[model samples]
Target: MRDYFIRRLLLIIPTLLGATIAVFFITRIVPGGPLEARMRQAMAMASERSMKDAGGSLSEEQKEQLAAYYGFDKPFFPAYLIWLGAAPQEVEKQFIKFEEGQNEAKVTLKTLLPRAQWTATNAFKVSEATVDRKGALTGPDVVGWKTKAEPEKQRVTVFRTKFNGLLQGNLGVSTRYNDRVWAMIKERMPVSIFYGLITFILTYAVCIPLGVIKAIKHRTVLDNATSVVIFIGYAVPGFVLGSLLVVYLAARMGWFPTGGFVSDNFSQLSVSGKVWDLTHHAILPLICYMVGGFAFMTMLVKNNLMDNLAADYVRTAIAKGATFRGAVLGHALRNSLIPLATTLGQIVTVFVGGSILIERIFDIDGFGMLSFQAVTDRDYPLVMGVLVVSAFLTLLGNILSDFFVALADPRIRFR
Candidate 1:
């Protein structure tokens, strides 16, 4: 198992790399760039100010500066390299000489060559030069032969991409939120986990026992009634149920809060009051999240248990002087849970992804809603951050589910 785990962990590197590459290029193919969006926002603000205070729009030089600031002036591949922190920032510096009689100063475009050589072009021939202590030249030998003025330095970014983004825990900044992507995710994660964990716990707690009962009372009226109830819950979508609950329970009866995960004045409440307020706000959203899972998981458990009960080994156990209860509980029950155990991976994935529509309907500011907003706003950094986290969890979940399956069924082994 140790070796198996090590190998699986090592395999995640290439898998994640491929996933990131796909996400990066695919997002790039989207219709608009972040710089363009920023420009539009700036123009809109300028327009608003103009209407109120007679302010002018952004100048051409200001527009270029904005493009340069965001590194949009460079080619896509070079910008991508810079983003990955793969290359150093390139700066443009110009050397100017003040001639005695010339109207304009003699300007020589000098850039630091790859080997630290100062290469000057589009200027007069070199006559004399002075190198500084650091090998940086103060005065270059020029044919124009005059006093030197202050050199102009303009910084431009190149291959500056941070390849260690995932490793170093920096997921980059969101253009839409104007904040770090990780920070935004961190803020929203707790709400999602709160709802997801509750749904998971309750779904298993209720469904497993209910399934066992239904399987035990197969073809009885109780079983038939349970089937009708769970199927009805299953058929209704969580968003639809949430809307109905809001209209009937919140609007009509005033039993629960219509939307949101907590009261606005929750912090001012007493401890018990806080808990009650939280539960009140949570009731509708929690119900919406759990109903679909409850129905599906209950039916799954029932079918798996029923199949295991009819197996020859279960019959053999009962024939060998074991009580029917012992045969079912000790032998059949264990085997029945194996199939459910395999679904643990999917559960982890769902926990991370959350329910987008349900969260949007309830106005819960969870990870799911964040993702939905990111996609709609074309926030590439946040979108990619969410995708990376989801992908990692999915891969990790598969490994965990394999271990769980191995533990549940003694016949299953990791080599």
Candidate 2:
């Protein structure tokens, strides 16, 4: 079992690589990218200028600057490698001038706060130039010589590269929001986690017991009534249910808050007040989030338990002077839970976020909403950043499910 898990863990690297490579390449090929959007904006501005005087298009230098700014200047593979932190990311070019009178020349170079070497080329001779966090130049004295004898103002461009990507814990910056991608993801993660955790706990907590009761009381009025309700919930989507709840419960009856994860002054509340505030805000959304899963999980538990109860071992246990509760709880219930245990790991992925439409309907700022906005705005960095976290979690969840299955069923063993 240990060796099997080790192999699964190692396989995640290549699996994730293959998945991300497809998505990374697709982002590059897609239209309406950052560069195109910038160009459209520039053209719109130029059109406005045309009304005032004459139309002006972006120059080649301006286009190249835009391309470089969005990291679109590199080829597909190099850009992907840089994003994975396997290749160095190019920083903005800095220039230094060697004047005739100045004895010592100092130039401030922009860096990602890491120690890096800046090489000067074209009409300048620089040896081993390095910059610290404070942007101070170090190393041997910088010397410059021109082709002409007379000393002249010689401008030399410095090239610098930094390894900033997934390996470096940098997800790049969002082209749309102009913010760090990981920062945005971190900011919205909590809201989704709160909803997801609550939904998971409540779904299992309520569904499992209810399923047991239904299975035991099969063909009774209690079972028939609950089945109708469960099917209704299964048929209705979470977002649609959320809308109905908001309208009827919030808009008409004024029972619950309309939408949002919390109140405006949530931070200012006392401890118990904060708890009440969260509960108050959570009621409607939580109901919507749990409804769909509640139905399916309940039915799954009921059917599995029923099947196990009818098995030969359960009948034998009951015939051997064991109580009905013992036969159900000790023997049948354990076997019935194998399917649920196998799927338990998959539920972990929801810690990142909930349904996008449900989030939009509730006006909650969560990871799901961030992902939707990133894709809609064509924010490549943010999209890829979200994908990286999500894909990793999903893959890990699958392995976890397998481990859980092994634990639930003693007969199962990994080779």
Candidate 3:
């Protein structure tokens, strides 16, 4: 079992690699990326400044500068490498003064590559170049200097690349929000986790015992009534239920807060007040989150327990003078839980897998909502960051599920 688990752990690398590679390449090939969006913004700004028809596009030089800034200047593989932190990326640029003479001042810039290797084929292709008043390179094409003419004393831009990305704990920045991807994730993670944990705990706490009761009271009015109620809940989606709850429970009845994770003045409230406010706000959303899962889990437990109780071992245990309750609890219940163990590891996704629609309806800022925004906005870095975290968790959850299955059914073994 240990060896089997180790092999499964090793397989995570390739699994994650394949998933990320496919997504990374797709994001690159997709149209309307960050570059195009930025260009449109620039064009809009230019149109506004000139107060003219929006027919003009950015110049070639402007496009080149934007491409380099966004790292689109490189081909697919190199850019992907830079994002993975396996290859260096442009981090900073600064122009340096080399020589100062009465008549002429000489400045030199370094490329990302070695100075000696790049000097000959450099964009400027000259030993020395003078800047014009307009901040453009006056000499032959210079590598780092602006293509536009600039003042002689203008500060020239020199660029430097560095090894900084996923491998270095940098998830990159959001193109749309202009914020660190990790920071944004951290800010919203707690809300999703809170919802997930509560839902998980409540689902198990209520469903399992309910299932056991239904199994023992099979075909009775109590069991049939519960089955009807749960099936009704299972038929309705969580988001739809949330909308209904918002309308009747919050808007008309005035019981719980309509939306948001907490009250506006929660910070100023006392500890007890804070707790009550949080609970009051959480009631509607939590109900919506748990409704679907509650029904499914209850049914799953009931069916599994019923099947196990009818098995030969459980029947024999009861026939051999063991009490009915003891036979059900000791023999049938443990075996019945084996199937549930397969999904136990899914608890990980709960950290970030709050229902997007449910969260949107509730006006909650959470990981799922953030992921939805990232994809819709085409924020590549943020999208990739979310994918990385979510993919890892999902892979890890599968392995944990397997481990749990093994634990629940000792009769089972791995080679």
Best by TM-score: 2
- From the highest lDDT down, the ranking of the candidates is 2, 3, 1
How many clashes show up in model 2? 0
Model 2: residues >4 Å from true position, as ranges? 48-56, 94-108, 112-157
lDDT of each: 0.72, 0.82, 0.81
Quickly count the clashes in candidate 3.
16
lDDT of 1 by residue, 1-415 (tens): 8799889988887898788777777777776667667666676776555543221466654565666654556676665555555543333322333334433423343332354453464332233344222223334543222232333322111111224445556677788878998888878877877787777788888999999999999999999999999889989998999989989999899888878888889889999998898888888898888888887788888899999999999999889899988988999888888888877765676546578898888788888999999988888878878988888888988888888898888898788
* Pick by lDDT: 1 or 2, better one: 2
Clash count list over all predictions: 15, 0, 16
lDDT (10s digit) by residue, model 3, range 1-415: 9999999999998887788889989898998889878877777877555434222467655676778777787898899889989998765433433334433344444335556556654633334566433344544546544432223544344444588888899999999999999999989889988999998999899999999999999999999999999888989998999999999999899988888988889899999999999899898888888889877788889999999988999889988999999999998998887898988999998767788898899889999899999988989999999999999999899999999999888888987
- For model 2, residues 6-91, the per-residue Cα lDDT tens digits are 99999999987898799999999998888888887777776655533221468755676678789998999999999999998766
List residue ranges in candidate 3 displaced over 4 A.
48-57, 93-157
- Between prediction 1 and prediction 2, the one with superior TM-score is 2
Per-model TM-score on C-alpha atoms = 0.77, 0.85, 0.83
